[model samples]
Target: MIIIQLNQRQQKIIEIVKENQPITSENIASMLNVTRATLRSDLAILTMTGILDARPKVGYFYTGVNQINLLGNDIKEKKVEDMMGMPVVVKKDVSLYDVIVEMFLSDVGSIFIIDDQENLCGVVSRKDLLKATIGGLDINKMPIGMIMTRTPNVVTVKREDSIVLAARKIIEHEIDSIPVVDMDDEHNVTKVIGRISKTNITKLFLEIAGE
Candidate 1:
């Protein structure tokens, strides 16, 4: 990949995000007295360089690139189980509308779906819900199971897995989160115990850098 040096505008963008974090692209452009179209490439470069964090429906925030290297060495061997957040689960038979309410209440991207056995069966993402709701389907009575990405297709990590591996899987899959699971060899299924998300990893980096 060709290296593109950070220009003065990019630097100013970083400073802007640092001060007024979670600022939208429109706002950032207005601050710089430019159109969002003019700022797009610059914003793209900054984010691609790990200098800024962009969240959909949210906005841009500085990821503290300077401190990222501080935790680079320490993060490789960290265990995901120690850092993963509590799993958010919903019964497969639960109404899609109910799941949507829970998703907003919990502020999570993906919600794990379980059967009567409470074993991990599927995963439903915010995108999935949005797409489902865009059309006038009876979501009030629609079951989440009908729309979920069934397991075996779901990417996951074990509690004992390294944080590096979890990070890799997340990047490779381009998913918002991965369920930390426990295997049931006898039953040949996985149980969702926790979830490791981009937010969790970001916090882990910040904590490590602080330490």
Candidate 2:
């Protein structure tokens, strides 16, 4: 169930091709007052989605398939690795103040802590920091390791995991984000590479809604 809410140009392209079957891309571009390069991606998307049929040396033909916006299949196929953002990682030995500073600078709700081997060892969230602050802990003197939620207690997602799986973990753990990790089977450790958060999933939902 792939959803394709056609934009104005795409719909217009469909109409143009519908009116003039077997029309060349060059003529379509001239009709739309845009360059062939500008319509290249749109044409490609249309053809791939079965909205338009293209023939080499010929032109485009309307397939009589209107835009469909069901989003299930595409969403289900999305993986965490491709969608995850660069993670904000700091050494476990770093001061709590340094971690806080980095978190603010990066504008992330959570920060991943790495060990000397650069493997993920712990995670800290804004609520965790706040709790530490409330406990009268001195951020300047405290090591991030002391406050982090250490693994294997920390929740994580593999690069091959589906976005749906990642979203489920976030909801279950009630955390803002989860690290995208690669497991070292021989060493029994995981290395953090990326992160997925509510914001990312929200954007995906918005796209699905065609809003």
Candidate 3:
């Protein structure tokens, strides 16, 4: 069987259908506090994915089993590189002011810091810049490297690592983004190749659900 992962809203829809089989789309929308039109796309996706079966004059019915377990296994087996976004990077010697500007221009929550040779050195987040501002430090004169979360302390993931592991690192460390790194034979970070964020994970879930 081809197992497809469902998002939270999709799972909720399945639950409602299971409990109240043959329920009309109008009633389902009312129960979920959404417009029937709003649910049209979701319904279409579920039906097309074979997760739900809709009958004329009847309602929606659940047709799959062990969906949650299968989804969990699928996520565990997925690789980080497949879902990672391009990394936004800055030189370690970049001015603190410039770093903040780069973060805004790139529209990323975090930025990777690299050295003259383009080696991974550190990472800076919006929170870090905020703290620096609140501290009344000179943003223009200070180099971002001085305030960045340095290597050995930065939480990173290998491109080939499981996405599940990367997700755990995000949750455990309370970070918004993680740098996907390539390492040398000795396991030292050699390059900042990509990034994985909560948004990336959400997009992956949506894609799996055929949305």
Candidate 4:
């Protein structure tokens, strides 16, 4: 399910795509010496799972890179509010322990901390919490606000920005995630979103490649 380890045939399909060759079930079956029906099942399973994109005439191709670029060009036709995550927030007054627990339970490495007015006040990372606790600070008593990275320094993406831009930010910043902020305001994070994780990039590639 994680899509990290892939089978040999799946890896071969990806290699073909990487070569920019015409990819199809028939072609794949002939190349791999498999049945056309079997190849169809593989493609169907991949495309239906969001790992592959079936173009009108182009058949199957890698979705991670191409899909992201397509999303970039298509973004000009839509708004950021259409794709951003909903408002899921953590309060500044919450304890670091609680924040860590939330991070694990939510399966996110980074979390956004907001003020009472719902404004993005600070950003917290697992490292921040770990450092505080290892320094002999009481996680339960210390407010997350004391350890969070303050505003004007946190990396953020606007809701209206292209998803490609969001993915690029994650790579360029070497960060696990970013906050989706509203540009109309003073860059207040309306949603906490993530991109470029192994789940999105590698797994997607494997599945699309029919792994």
**TM-score winner among the candidates?**
2
Q: Which residue pairs come into collision in candidate 4?
A: 80-159
* Number of the top lDDT candidate: 2
Ranking by lDDT: 2, 1, 3, 4
Residues 1-211 of candidate 1: C-alpha lDDT, one tens digit per residue: 1334579999899999999999999999999999999999999988877889999979998988773453344466789888999999999999999999999999999999999988899999999999999978789999999999997798999999998899999999999999999998899767899999999889886875565
Q: Candidate 1 lDDT (Cα, whole model)?
A: 0.90
Worst 10 residues of 3 by lDDT: 65-74
> What is model 2's C-alpha RMSD?
9.8
TM-score of 3: 0.66
Local lDDT at 202 for model 1: 90
Q: What is the C-alpha lDDT profile of model 2 across 55-134, one tens digit per residue?
A: 99998999886454424566787999878999999999999889989989999999999999899999999999989988
lDDT of every model, 2 decimals = 0.90, 0.91, 0.89, 0.67
Query: Can you write out model 3's per-residue Cα lDDT over 1-211, one digit (the tens) per residue?
Result: 3664567888789889989998999999999999999899889978876678999898898886544543445667899988999999999999999999999999999999999878898999999999998899999999999999998899999999998899899999999999999889576537999999999988877987779
Model 1 misses residue 178 by how many Å? Answer: 0.6
* Candidate 3 residue pairs that clash: none
| Alpha-carbon lDDT of model 2 | 0.91
RMSD of candidates 1 onward, in order: 15.9, 9.8, 10.0, 10.1
List the lowest-lDDT window of 10 residues for candidate 2.
65-74
